[model samples]
Target chain A: PRMKLVLVDHNEFAQAVAGADEAEIIEVIDHHRLSGNLRTKEPIRFINEPVGSTSTIVGIMYRMREAAPDKSTAICLCAGIISDTLHLTSPTTTSTDKEILEWLAGIGGIDSAQFVKDFFAAGSMLREHTPDRALESDRKVFEENGWHISISQIEELGLEEFWKRETELQGALQALLTKHSLHFACLMVTDITRHHSVLLVAGDQRVIDAIDYPQAKEHVYDMAGVVSRKKQLFPYMSHVVTKLDAP
Target chain B: PRMKLVLVDHNEFAQAVAGADEAEIIEVIDHHRLSGNLRTKEPIRFINEPVGSTSTIVGIMYRMREAAPDKSTAICLCAGIISDTLHLTSPTTTSTDKEILEWLAGIGGIDSAQFVKDFFAAGSMLREHTPDRALESDRKVFEENGWHISISQIEELGLEEFWKRETELQGALQALLTKHSLHFACLMVTDITRHHSVLLVAGDQRVIDAIDYPQAKEHVYDMAGVVSRKKQLFPYMSHVVTKLDAP
Candidate 1:
C-alpha cells in the first residue's frame, strides 16, 4: 500500500525507518541537522528547530494548537525529553527544553529530580549487555570528508562498570572497525549522574593521535563534563577530520 | 562584518542573495520545495509549509504570536499572497492562504476584488520591458540530473503584448541558452487575469521535442490555465527533461 508519512525527531532518510524513501513524506518535525537529500513531490509542512529534543518541539505544538496530551502520552514525551537531553544537563538543552520539560512533568505528575535519578539507575548498558552489544546499542555512523566514522554512546550512573569492562569494549570497537570498513570507531561511556564521559577509540593512528582530551590510558581519554554527542564530540571529530594532514 | 539572516519565501541558497553561503542562516520560512543544500553550524529554526505563498505563513506566525502587522505591512503581505496565488485562483492556493489573505485584507481595509484588479493592471512585464529584460525579470535556474535549465516567468494582464513580442522573446531564450551554457531555457508568459499561460522554448532538440503540451506554433505551447511556474510549468518541464531519450 502507498503510505504517507510524517517524520518526527529525525529527518535524514539514512536514519529513518526502512522503506521511508518510497513513502510520501507529508510533514517533518525534527531537531537535527538537515541532511539535504529528502525531496517531496510538493511543498509539505516541515518544522526544524534547534532545541535539545524533538519532544520539546512536539510539546510546543500541543500548546500552539490548544491540545492536551493524555497523562500517559505526557509521561512518554517527558521521558523522551529527559533521555535525549540527559535530564537537561546536556549542552544541547535550550530554554524551550527547560520550559517544556516543566510543563510536561507537571502534567505527568512527575518529580523531575526523582525521575532523573530513577531513569539513570534503571539501566546500566555496561553491566547488562555484552561488550559488543553495549558498543552497538546506540551507535551512529557519520560521513565526514570521505571518512566513515562510527560513534556509539552508552549512558550510565557511574564509571565503575566501564572501568571493569574497558578492555573488552576496546576489543569490540576494534572489531567494529574491520567489520564495517570504518575509518574510525569509538565508544563514549557517559556518566550522566556526574556529567562526564570517557572515550574508547580504535581506528587510524593519525586520527587517534589527533585526540586532545587528557588520556586516561593508551586508547581511552577522560572527557570531563562532555555528554552531548551532537553538540560536543561530533563537532570535535569533524574538526579533527577536516584538519587531518593530506594523504 | 558577519551577519545573521532570516530567509523568507525561498530556501535554496542557489536562489538566495550574494554571499549567502558565508552568512549565518538563522531562520527560514518558505513555501517552496526544499533544495536541501542548506547546512548551518547549529540547528536553526526552519518552517516550510505547502501553502500558496510565504506571506500566508508569516500571517499565520503573526496570529500565532498574538501580534498584527501594521496597515502598510498588511497590504504588502496581501499583495504577496495575491500575486503568488493569483488572487486565490492558483491551484497552489490552500485554505490557509485564503484565510490569511482575508485577514490581511481586512486589516489593510482592502476590497480584495478591487485590489486584484488594480494589482494586475499595475504592471505588464511584456509591455514595459524589452524581450530580454522581460525574460530575465523573474528567472530561476535549476539543476536536475546534470541538466542546467533556466525557467523565467512574466505575468501580464493579457497575451496581446506577448503576441507582439514573441519573436524577440524566442531570440532572448536562445541567447540565454548560449550565455549560461544551459542545457535548456524557456519563458512562460502568464495572463493572471485569465489564469492561463504560454511557454516559449529554445533548447536541445531532444528536450524541446519531449514537451507534451499542445503546440501553439514552432517553439511555443499554449498552456491554458497554467498560471503557476512552481506548481505547474516547472513540473511539466522537469518531467519532459527526465523522459528525454538518452544521448
Candidate 2:
C-alpha cells in the first residue's frame, strides 16, 4: 500500500493511522507544537522541525534519506517552507531553520534572489483560488479548551491583491464554518514575507469579540511578526481562549 | 499515560509526541546512525544529531528540554556517547556533535578533560563484564547483499583484559548468534583512542577465512585504525560479503 499524508495535532490519531495495515506510513514530516504519540511500528522515516511548515520538515527528510536531496524535492520543500513561514520573516523562524535553509540553498540548487521572486509569484496567484479555497487549502483542525476550532492560513498577493481577496476570504471563512459545523473559524490572512497576520474571525461573534488582540480594523486583528502558527498563533490563540473562558 | 521513548532520525517525532500527551516523553537525544525503531506519544523534548550515540542524543535533549540537564543525566549522556563512539573519535561523528559537546560540556557543569575521564571510565568497565558483554553492548545489525549480519564494537581496554575476556566474549557471541538467529556475527574490538579494531567473527568459518585483509592475525583478526563502522568496518564487511557471495 502507498503512503498518504496524515496531518495531525494529536498523537492517537497519528498512532492509529500509522498502525493501520495498508498504511506504509513511510514518512512523517511535521512542524507543530509538540504532542507525544509519534510511535509507529512501520519502518518509517521522519523529519520534524520547530519551523513554520512541514515543507521544511520534508527538506531535511530529503537530505537524510538520499544523502543528497534531488533538485525537484528540494525546490518544492524549500518553496513550501518559504511560503508557509513567509520566508525567514516569520518570528517562528529559528536558528535551526536558518541552518537548514543555508543547507537547503546549497543542496536544492536555489538562488536566494531568484527564489524570492518566484515564490511570491506562486503565492500571489490570487485569481486562481477563491477566498474559501485559499483559506481551506492550508487549514488545521483541533479541539481547544472545549470548542472545536479550525484555523486556516490564507496568504495572497501583497497589498494589491489583499483588498480583492478580502471579501472572498471572508465569505470562504463563513462557508467553511457552516460546512464543517465549526464553533468558530479563524483565517490568518497573512503576508508571511511581511511578517504580519491579518486575523479574520467569524461564526460566533461572541467568541470572536471575546478574544483580545491588536485591532487592525474593528473585528480584524493584526499581529506583527507572526509567521508561524505553531510558535506565534497557537500561543496567542491559547491566550484568547483563556480570556473567553474567564469567569 | 506516560511518554515512552520514540527514537527517529529527526526532531518531528519528538515534538509531535510532546504535544499528544501530557505525559512528557521528557528527553530525546540521539546520534544520527540511521538505525533503531523508537516510538513515543508525548512531548519528548529531544536532541538528535549526526553524532555517535543516543547518549549524546539525550544530552542535547536536556539542553532543550529543562533548559538544563541535571548532573547525572548530563554525565550519563556525555559518557554514553563518548563511550559509544569513542569520544567524538569516530568518523561518523558530525560537526553537530562537536558543537553540541562543546555546549554540553559548558552547560553540564563539567570540563572537557574531566568529561573524557568520567565517560571512558564508565565505558571501560572491563572488570564488570565478560569479553562478550563488552563486545555485544555496542552492536549494530546490518544487511549487506543477501546476508544479515550483526556487528559488535569494543574499545580501549588493555591487552591483558582483552585476552582474558576473549573466551567469555566468544561464548557470549555464540549465544547471541542463537538468540538473534543471525547468519553471522562480527566483533570489532577497537582501541578507539588508539585507533584499531581486533576483528572477531563467529558463524561460518568460510566467511571469516575468506577475508583476505593483510593485517588479519591468526586465531584473532587484528586491523589497525579500524575504528569507524562507516569508514572502516562497513567497507571491509561489504567487500567480504561480496567475496562470500561470488559464485
TM-score of each model, paired residue for residue: 0.92, 0.50
Task: Quote model 2's TM-score.
Answer: 0.50
DockQ of 2: 0.05
Could you give the interface RMSD of each candidate, to one decimal? 1.8, 8.5
Quantify all predictions' global Cα lDDT against the true fold: 0.86, 0.61
True contacts kept of each: 0.59, 0.02
TM-score of chain A for the candidates in order shown: 0.92, 0.76
On the 0 to 100 scale, the lDDT of residue A202 in model 1 is: 92
CAPRI accuracy category, model 1: medium
lDDT agreement of model 1 with the native? 0.86
TM-score top scorer: 1
Task: Name model 2 segments beyond 4 Å from true.
Answer: A1-27, A37-47, A52-66, A123-125, A242-247, B1-27, B30-53, B56-247
